[model samples]
Target chain A: MSVSDTHRTIDAIWRIESAKLIAVLTRIVRDIGLAEDLAHDALVIALEQWSQNGIPNNPGAWLMTTAKRRAIDLIRRNKLRDQKYSEVARNTDLYTEDDMDHNLDGEIGDDLLRLIFMTCHPVLPQEGRVALTLRLLCGLTTDEIARSFLAAEATIAQRIVRAKRTLRDRDIPFEVPAGEELSDRLSAVLEVIYLMFNEGYSATSGNQWIRPLICQEALRLGRVLAEIVPYEPEVHGLVALMEIQSSRFRTRVNSRGEPVLLMDQNRAEWDQLLIRRGLKALDRSQKLGRPFGPYSLQAAISACHAKAPTAPETDWIRIAALYEALSRVLPSPIVDLNRAVAVSMAFGPDFGLQIVDMLGNESSLKGYHLLPSVRGDLLVKLGRFDEARKEFEHAASMTRNERERELLLKRAAECNSAH
Target chain B: MRFMFIVKATGYSEAGGNYNQKYTDAMIAYKKSLAGAGVLVSAEALHPSSTGIRIMYPSDSEKPEILVGPFLADQELIAEYTLIDVDSEADALNWALRMPVPTGCGEFKIEVRKLKKNLGFLRYSGTCALEADLKDQLSMLKNF
Candidate 1:
């Protein structure tokens, strides 16, 4: 194979293997920073040696073996500097077993879960936890994480640095929080996954409207998370929400990659299989018999859309009620705006306009482009062409997505010509 | 019309020193109000002037000059800014007047400047087609 071809193969392999390698190493090393270094060291070795020796048939095992050797070397060399070495090293049977590979595979889920919990440790800042988790657990580079979050690379890099240091200095255990602590930590983990999915669903700031790769990674993570913690209703709720939302990924953007608004999208293009899976997950969450949390409520909202044959046929009344419930539980102006949309569809533009108009002075919505967009839609429905034109133009300016801006501008122009 | 509210730096802010929690709280509250009103366009807090750099082009085109700060005009340096589109200059001024003292010091100053109009000067041909091509190129590059 050509050198570039070898490098490409190695890159793909690393993405699949690196997370498992780091999770397993973090289990042994008990230090995220050190575990990451060891995993990186193994990757450097793979890049150097794989080109010469040809790619190994058992590449994961090869990386694992290489990383474990490095761990042993690190423990010996930095035995004095590293407190973790002293703690885990004293236990001779920790990583030196002949059946270490089998053992690592056996406890891989636990290690991955532990890694998730550790990376999302509550002590670290929210953004930091997310940055670190994406870096280690999802095999995302700092640049990818920054782009996904619509943040600067330097900011993400610093957050990761601070997170790893906090993990070490605070001696945050490399295990899932137990008892009362478990649910709180779990929420943060779920949040990180959801954040990743949201970025994919509707990119916050980018030329492209949807980032399917990010959504796919998030869905994979959520599925893995669901497998690890089957009893958690919220986990199922979150998974259901992502599945249903992701079902429309193909329809969300047109052949030209322009965004298709929910009401305008071709319903036939929505993925039925994913919708079924999402409904099943929602049912599982409901069967748990707990009060519906934010995720399940949102999933319920999405399920309403999935069941509808057409946008006009959608159960807007039920969605409005769900958003009302969501506002009571997870109150935010965004929810209020969404509820306004549902209310407008279910009842009339006037009813929704009242709610939206009340939020005119809402401080949180000032920089929010969607508020103007939603208002513009309502105004158009109300036959206020001039007002609608202004709102659309305002929204177009606020939007960072190039296609979204273009669509908004098109709407503004249409309103202008009509007026 | 859109106006830019420039927050002038003070001696306290330029030293890279920490401020009281209430100072940050007030700033957050101010930003929240701007966002809530549906008038705010964009906002950002600039880093200390020490980290800033300026490139000066020579008239003769022999060479460009690069200048790094701590620029001597520390007091004149911008600490932050917010852009807002309001109905009138008076409306913009009202919002600017309502802005909280950034450092909780009684003597904070903010300057609001109206942006130059884009309509007259930006009548370029094939702008949409060019922008579309550029957008495709950018999206393609983003995957890396």
Candidate 2:
């Protein structure tokens, strides 16, 4: 292989092995920032040696061994420095090479889980959590993570550096939380993953509607988490929801790059494999015998759409029922709005209009464009063309997406022609 | 992103030569690792070219031509393929590089190609930003 090819191979190996290497090193050193530094040190060493001697047979193990050696050397140096400074500091916990060897083999899965929890800890800001998670758990470079989020590379680098510092300063334990704390911490982790997925699934601020690469990364991370925490129903639930949603990615927009509503999407074009995988994940969540959380409830709703042969054949009643259950578990105006849409499909536009009108006074949804959009659709169904046109125009004005605004204006025009 | 790793057919593979126990064990272990990472979408080995047929359109007329295989050029034919969904091309390459070498099968090649997914909006709307960002990121990776 050429020099560039060898470098690319090393980079690939680093991507695959870095997460595990960092996770293990953190456990040994008990410092996330230091662990990362040691892992990178090992990577630099591998880049030099692998090109000379060819790649190792087991690259992950090779990297781990190299990183562990560096960790031991650093600890020894720190111990010597501490001994010269103060006698009391000599008693601090430090691992020898033998201790490191004993601790390295097993519990790597647990170490990774702990790493996820640490990165997604509620102590850090949401953006920090996201940046840290992508950096530590997904093995993404600062540049790649920056590009994925459409942020500046230096900003991402600073965010990562600050997040690691916070993790160290706060002295967060390198273990998964337990008891009631476990569920809360797990939700934080799930929220970070879901946020990453949504950032890709729907570009809230960009001209592009979908960023498939970010979604793929989020889905891969969710899958990894699900394997590590198989008993956590919500983990499987989140995976199921992402899988089902991702199946529609191809059909979510048109050839001209206009948005396509769920009902208008081509059912035959939806990816069957992903839908099946999602259903299987949902089944796993159900088998865990826990009450459906927000994600599972949503996945159950998506499954209803996936199972339907066509839009008209969708089980709106079941979906409405699921939405009602979801509202009780995780009440929000957005859930209520979705419930209203399902109710309209299952019952009548008047019934849906009543719910939508009630949400008119919802302070949280005052600036939410989807409210007016849904209300407009119901008003049109009820033959209130004038009101529907006004609502669509309002929605069009409120929306930030150029394509969605165009769609809303088109709806308003349709209402005008109908009248 | 999703990638397909296509293992090219070799003379030994085309002749249906059996793999030794060591190679078979290594291949199984490699597949297990792929599944453990939750990246393996599907993997399958194809039957020899003799079992396959190809349909071709003759350019001069509307008529079609059917050809039976035992086709020429073993290097051009695929013996097997594994599809994996990963975070990036680098991650896919990482997995591909770890694949066990097939011993006593002469030399073989695994070609990696990304599966195309619909990103019409990104292509049409964010072409400049996306291409420029990707180029910048590639250069950054090269520096590392």
Candidate 3:
């Protein structure tokens, strides 16, 4: 292969193996920042050597061995600097090459999980956690994470640097939390992953409709998480939710880049393979014999739509029930608003209007555009066209997204013409 | 991006001979790993070409030509395919490289091809448009 081709191959191998390499390194060195540096050193060496010697037969193992050697060297050099280094040096001597290989194969899953927990520790700010998780666990460059989230590269770089420092200063243990702490930490980890997925699934404010790469990265992380923590229902639930939502990417927007309502999306164009994987994940979550969590509930709601042959054939009653359950578990006005939509479809406009009108007094949803947008749809269904037009106009004014505002305004115009 | 790993048919596959137990187990393990990683979209093994048919549209004639298979050239045929959605072509290639080669089969090859997106939109546009129209009418009726 050419030099550039070799570089590309090494890049791919690095993306696949870096997280595992760093995870194992962190376990050995007991410092995330140091682990990452050691992994990078190994990568740099591979780039230099692989181009000349050709790629190794097992690139991952090669990278691991190289990083471990770097870890041992760093400890040896710093042996007098700190007691921790001396201890790590002593531990390192117990492992020969064969033991290192066995440890990598056997302990990688647990080490990776620990790395995720450390990155997503609740002690750090949410943005810090997100930046660090993508940087360390997802093998994303700081520039890529910045571009994906529409942040300044320097800001992302600073965020990651600070996050790593905080991880070191806080002296977070490089192990999964036990018992009561486990659930909270795991949720924190899941939240960071889901937040990454949402930021990609929907551009909250920008002209861009979707940042697919971010969603793909998030989904990949979730899948990996599910594999490592197979018994965790919520992990599978989150994966299911992301997979099902991702399946709708194609029909979620028009060719002109306007927002397309879920009901209006072309069901035939939905990715069946993703839908199948999503449903399988949901099944796995259910089969774990635990009560459904918020993500699983949402996945169930999406699955209702996925299973429908057409919009009119959708099981809105079941969806309404799911939303009711979701509202109970999650207790957000947003869930209630979604429940109203399902109720309107399952029952009638009047019943939905009652619930939505009750929500109008909600303090949390005061400036939420979707509230008015959904209210407008129910009003239109009730033949209250003038009121519907005003609601749509209000929703249009409240929305920040250019495409969403255009869609709401179009709905308002349609209501005007209907009257 | 989505990629299709086209597992090209071998002489043994074309002859409809079953894979050895070892190869079958290895293939299963490979697919399990793919699914575990969440990159796997779909995987399917095709029946031998003898069970299939090929259709050809001739430019000169109003009628299309149909050929019954037991097609020639086993190497050109696909015996199985696995679809995956990954971040890049490199990632797809990495996954393709990990696919288990059938033991005892001569000259195993898996071709990786990136699938073009939005092709389905063109194919289903007419039906989707009709569905939208039908939905409009139904909503109108409900409103009245």
Candidate 4:
């Protein structure tokens, strides 16, 4: 292979392997910030030498070995500074390659769980937690994250810096919280994963409707978490949610990559493997015998779709009921908005409009483009073209996604023609 | 000497609104380039002053004055910190001069100064205990 090809191969390897590398490194280093820095140092070395040397047969092993060596170097340098840094570094060196290989077999799940918990630690603010997790665990760039949130790159960049510094400054322990703290931290972990999945499902700002790489990463992480904390009902719930949602990935976009709305998608295109995984996860969630949390309830709703042979065969009433349960457990304006759509499908547009109208005064939905988008769809169904047109136009104006904006504007034009 | 740049103080309104992805990508590239050159130590964008209060020590008194504001002014916010492993301020500025144009907005500034160890004052000052106590209080307040 040419030098550029080697560079490309290394880049691809990093994208695929960085999370596991960091997870394993953090296990050894016990400092997330340092683990990430060491990972990057490995990446830099790969970028420089891989071109001439060609890609290694075991690229992951190469990266891991390089990162560990870099970690040792960093520690040795720090050893010059203070007794404390030296002592920590000395303790770290006790684990050799044999120890690492052995530890890897035992600690893959535990280490990933630890990394997730560390990223979502309560000390960092919510945005910081999400941004940092995406950067480290999902291998997303600051630009990718900013685009995902429709946020400024500078803003995401700043959030990440502060997040790392905050973690370092506070000396937050790199481990999963146990006991009561376990569930609370687990919820944060699940939230971060779901947040990642959601951004991928409907990219907040980009031209594309979905970012499959992000969704895949989230699903992989969720699966890892489920393995690490097999008994945590919520972990299973989250995995179930992601699996079912991901089943529709192929059907969600058309040949041209334009979004095909849920109702318009081809049922045949859904991945049966993902659906089966999702159903199994849902069964696992229920087997735990806990009341269905928000994710599990959402999964149950998705299972309704997975069971259906076609859109017309979908059990709308069950979906509506599940949404109601979701609302009770995690009553947010977005859930209510979604419930309105289900209610409209199950009952009638008039009934759905009533619930949606109740959300009209919700401050949270004031700028949340989806509210107006759903309202427009319902209005169009009710033959309220002028109002629907206005709603679609409003939604189109508010959305940052270029493709979504185009679709919304097209819908608005359709309403105009109908009128 | 490792120099840190603090963002300047200015109105959040004057800082303008949140930028778009294109602007943000540019900033990331800028930071990456700086990292490549080994000049950029660290950079962070703070939450607008609206999210939290800002407190500052008055030169005349030990107690700091609180203000509800962000780092809005170019002079107030320390935009970039250029840290040179080699000797002094001159070396730090030499690295800072290579930084690309400000990523998204108004005039940006860079400050070149030595990181204060303050070991002597830390040893002699009676206030060190109080400072430690304050840090403990702040740390306690962090999560909630």
The prediction achieving the highest DockQ against the true structure is 1
Question: What class would a CAPRI assessor give candidate 1's docking?
Answer: incorrect
Off by over 4 Å in 3: A93-101, A204-211, A361-373, A385-419, B1-144
> Each candidate's iRMS in angstroms?
18.9, 21.3, 15.6, 22.7
lDDT of 1: 0.77
Residues A1-419 of candidate 2 have per-residue lDDT tens digits of 87789899988988887888899888778889889999999999988998888887777777887887777767676875655323422333344444545655457789999999999998886777888888998888888887877765655665676577668888899998989999999999998888788767665233465555677888999999999999999999999999998898888778777656666678899999999999999999999998999889989988997998966677878987998898798887667777787777778778888988998987878998878888888887788999989999999999899987998899899999996
A7-103 per-residue lDDT for model 1 (tens digits) = 9998899898888889888877878988999999998999899989899877887888889888877787878897767666666343433565667
Residue pairs clashing, model 2: none
Model 1 C-alpha lDDT per residue in residues B60-95, reported as the tens digit of each score? 887889999877645578888988755568988999
Over 4 Å off, model 2: A80-106, A204-211, A361-369, A386-417, B1-144
Q: Which stretches of candidate 4 lie over 4 Å from their true place?
A: A27-30, A43-66, A69-73, A76-81, A93-99, A141-156, A204-212, A254-258, A333-419, B1-144
**Model 3 over residues B63-143: C-alpha lDDT tens digits?**
889999999855679999997755457888898898888776778889989897612111221123223222332342244
lDDT of 3 by residue, A247-363 (tens): 988887787787676667888999999999999999999999998998899889889878989767888789889988988988876677767767877888788889999999978
In order, the candidates keep a fraction of the true contacts of: 0.00, 0.00, 0.01, 0.00
Residue-level error in angstroms, candidate 3, position A39: 1.0
The per-residue C-alpha lDDT of model 3 at residue A8 equals 91
- C-alpha DockQ of every model: 0.03, 0.01, 0.01, 0.02
- Give all TM-scores, in the order shown: 0.63, 0.67, 0.69, 0.61
Candidate 3 global lDDT: 0.81
